[model samples]
Target: MDKLDKQSRTIKFFRERIPAFACIPGCHDCCGPVLASSVEMARLPRKSEQEQDAALAALSCPHLGAGGCQVYEERPLVCRLFGTTPRLACPNGKRPAVMVAPALEQRVYRYFEQVRHVLV
Candidate 1:
C-alpha cells in the first residue's frame, strides 16, 4: 500500500510527539516491565539482537535500566505511543479516554493497521 511509508512516518511522528509532549522532564516508567509490550522484542535494534531471546524470556527489556529506556530510539510501538496520563479513553467508548494528541493516535494506528508486518 502507498500508505506504508507514510503511515510509518506518521507513527514515527506521534511516537516522538507523544513522549515529548507528555512525559518529558519527569520520571517516566514507560519502559517498565509492567507495560512493556511483547512488541518491544521485535523492535529491539540489531545491536541488542544477541540479547533479544534472553530479554524476551525475562520479559525485561535489554535496553532498560534503573533510569529508563536505554535505546529509546529503538523502542517499540507501545513505548512510542504511551501517554503521560495514568489512563486514556476517548469518546469512542469501550476504550477509556485520557488526554493525548489525537493526530498522534490516528497516525500510529494508521501505520499499525496497514503495515501489520512491520513495527508501528
Candidate 2:
C-alpha cells in the first residue's frame, strides 16, 4: 500500500478506537482539565495522572466557550480525536467517560490538500 493508503487506514483505526469513550453531548465539561491545545505543549491527559484537577478550564480551541466548540472549522488534532475508549477519566468528577467525533473525514480530500481532517 502507498503512504496515502497507510495514513487512511490509521485514521480509520483511530476513529474506531476513540469512540469507545462516547462523549455525552451538553455535559458542560466533556473534556476536563488540560484541554487539548495546538499551539505548543498540549498533551492529552495521561491515564497515570491519578488525580485530574477536574475543573472547567479554558480549552485551546478557538471554538470552545460559553457556546461551545465555535471554530469547529480550525480545531486541532486532539479535539478531532475526542471520543475514544477507556473513557479517559472525567477530570470533572464524572464517571462514564466521553469521546470526540468530528465527522469531517467521511468526505474525500482535494488533490493538493492533504490532512486527516476526519478520521483523526
Residue pairs with backbone overlap in model 1: 88-96, 88-97, 88-98, 89-96, 89-97, 89-98, 90-97
lDDT of 1 by residue, 7-119 (tens): 55655565656643334443444444423223434455443555655665666656666676676676666655555323442222222244456666665556555554421
How far does residue 7 in candidate 1 sit from its true spot (Å)?
Answer: 4.9
| lDDT score, candidate 2 | 0.37
- Model 2: per-residue Cα lDDT over 46-74, one tens digit each: 22222222222333223345666544443
Give the TM-scores of the predictions, in the order they appear: 0.51, 0.35
Sliding window of 10 residues with minimal summed lDDT for model 1: 88-97
What TM-score would you give candidate 2 relative to the actual structure? 0.35
Best by TM-score: 1
lDDT of 1 at 42: 48
